[model samples]
Target chain A: MKQISTRLSMAVHTLCLIAMLPHECTGDFIAGSVNTNPVVIRRIMGMLKKAGLVDVRPGVGGAYLLRSPEEITLLDIYRAVNAAEEEQLFGIHVNSNIKCPVGRNIEGVLQAEFQAAQSAMEQQLSGVALKQLLSQFKE
Target chain B: MKQISTRLSMAVHTLCLIAMLPHECTGDFIAGSVNTNPVVIRRIMGMLKKAGLVDVRPGVGGAYLLRSPEEITLLDIYRAVNAAEEEQLFGIHVNSNIKCPVGRNIEGVLQAEFQAAQSAMEQQLSGVALKQLLSQFKE
Candidate 1:
């Protein structure tokens, strides 16, 4: 069974908390809620910050929301965390000689198809929002 | 950047070759095509055989395609190779107390989301045929 890493999951959760709390959230507080290390929370927050999703201040202050929950989707968080949306979701190591007919050509074709597949996946995730996830949380 | 491993990629490529070839393919033949150790090919073939994607006959005979190429998808190949689709794609390792509320709750929820995401991805790959992959082969 392939599994989703806690990093992306936790990152989304933290972002959601900030989105939910808006003005009152802190990285330490979010980390507590996520039951993870503060540094880990900060690393993810840094990415979200770069993406203009969140604002963070050093010392004595916590992270704050920059974007509305409605504007953010799971895909936003996913991309923010630097998920591999390109490349095959599974690696197939074929280091065959490029001089060989099948070896030289397969990767390009597979990558093209894989990209299309990932695009579809990103589209699905983009439609799901923090608000939608919160609804699931409420239930 | 988190990336998929080469093992699964090689396995899928190998499978695609067998699917496209005119007759039964052996590990030695596949190894030559893939430029890998025959033992490596057989090891992977063992996994594919267990997944019911291929059938193997020992003693003079090699492996043959049991499942139709069209019936299989990149995702099916992925699953057979034990590629971690949802969790850690590039291998992020973090240990949390499973007894914690966030830890316990997150795994189940995240897993479901990952599975959904993976299914969406799979459906896309499933739409493409190995025969299509054959068109891309060039020396």
Candidate 2:
């Protein structure tokens, strides 16, 4: 089946938790909320940190949002995790017969459409901020 | 990596070839153009046939487009192959901690956003007809 990676969702979830309670945000604690290993949480947090969306201190330090939730869009989280790797999005059969007209040209033919569709999806994602996502979590 | 299924592109390529030359379109011929095993072409053709987008002859026959290329949208091909299974588009982590507020609500919160993003992508796809895609292939 075709699938978008779960990294984008996981990153958003982790960020929402940190935004909700920045002081209580540790890899172990966030992992508890995400129901995954702290290692998994740290991996995603590491990506988020590299993207400047979150900050993680060394040793006993915890994680916190670098930007306000309202300022961070879902697109930010998606890009933070590099989840929009469009080449993989609509896979061209690598072994397509380069000798054949259809095979030779199919990739070029579909590239524009796939890109437009991906852009539309990302634009939709960009419209929703992390703050908006956090607001949906009922107390 | 995040990805959309390639089945949609394959189906479109197969259909474009069939539309361009309906009579000579056999699984072997399509496979030659697609550069995959005839079995793979047949598999996608099977789904397209099931979706009523194409017809495959039983004994000494080949494939043909059921509808004019002008009338078919990328969305039709997508649905034909079940490429848009939303669950696969943005996965919800099965192991999310049920006791946590963020865990309990993350799926619900992201569900709407994911749906909207998916809708936007499909809407973009719906705007482009297969005829337009076919036009992109030179010679």
Candidate 3:
């Protein structure tokens, strides 16, 4: 079955938690909130750090969002996680028979459509900011 | 890694081939072009048949498109194949720690965003007719 990366949602969740309470954002704490292994949280945190969306200090450090929730969109989280390859939003069957007319040309045709679809999804994601999501949480 | 269903593309390819050469679309032949097992082609063909997008005969028969290529869209093919669940497109981590405020509410927030993104993708898919795709193939 086709699946979007779980990492994207987890990253957003992690960031939202950090935005909500930045001081207590250790990997262990985030993992507890995310309900995943600290190793998993660290992996995602590593990606977010690389993307400049989050900062992680050395041995004694915790994680924190680099930007305000209001300034961060789901698109930002998505890109930070690097969850899904844009080109792979609709995969082309790799072993298509090139000798077959339809097989030879389907990739080009489908790719254009896939690109459009992916762009639409990204645009939709961009419209939703982390602040909007954070606001949904009850105190 | 996250991936979109290849079945959606394969279904389009299968239909394109059937439309291009209506007479010789046996499961084996389609599988050759798809470069997958005949059973795989049959599986997709079964879904297409259920969707009323294609017809299959009992014995000594093959697959054929039930509608003209112009009448079919990638959205139709996507739905036919049930490519990805709209909710599953952005999976919420099932194990979120309910004790955390953000974790407790994250699913509802992400779900709404995922729904919007899915709608956008579906709308984009609906706009591209299969005939438009088939037109890209060289004779």
Best by TM-score: 2
Give candidate 2 misplaced runs (Cα > 4 Å): A83-88, A94-100, B83-88
Residue-level lDDT tens digits of model 2 in B1-139: 6456677788888998888888888989998888778888898999999889989897876777888888899988888887344444676676688888889888878878888998999999899898997777766
Best by lDDT: 3
lDDT of 2 by residue, A1-139 (tens): 6466677788899998888888788899988888888998888998999889988887976778889888999888878787344443566555677877777788877887888888898899999998887777866
Candidate 2 residue B39 Cα shift, in angstroms, is 0.7
lDDT: which is higher, 1 or 3?
A: 3
Docking class of 3: medium
Give candidate 3 misplaced runs (Cα > 4 Å).
A83-87, B83-87
Tens-place lDDT per residue, model 3, A8-72, is 89998888878877778888999998898999989999988888888988688677778888888
Tens digits of per-residue lDDT for model 1 on B15-105?
7777666365778887887788989888888888888889888887666677676777776776677733443332223443454444435
RMSD over all Cα atoms, model 3: 2.2
DockQ scores for all predicted structures: 0.43, 0.67, 0.70
Q: What is the TM-score of chain A, computed separately for every candidate?
A: 0.81, 0.87, 0.88
Among these predictions, the greatest DockQ belongs to 3
Candidate 1 residue-wise lDDT, A1-117, digit = tens = 434455677777777667556555677776777776778888888888888888888775667767677888878877777755553454445567576567777677767877777
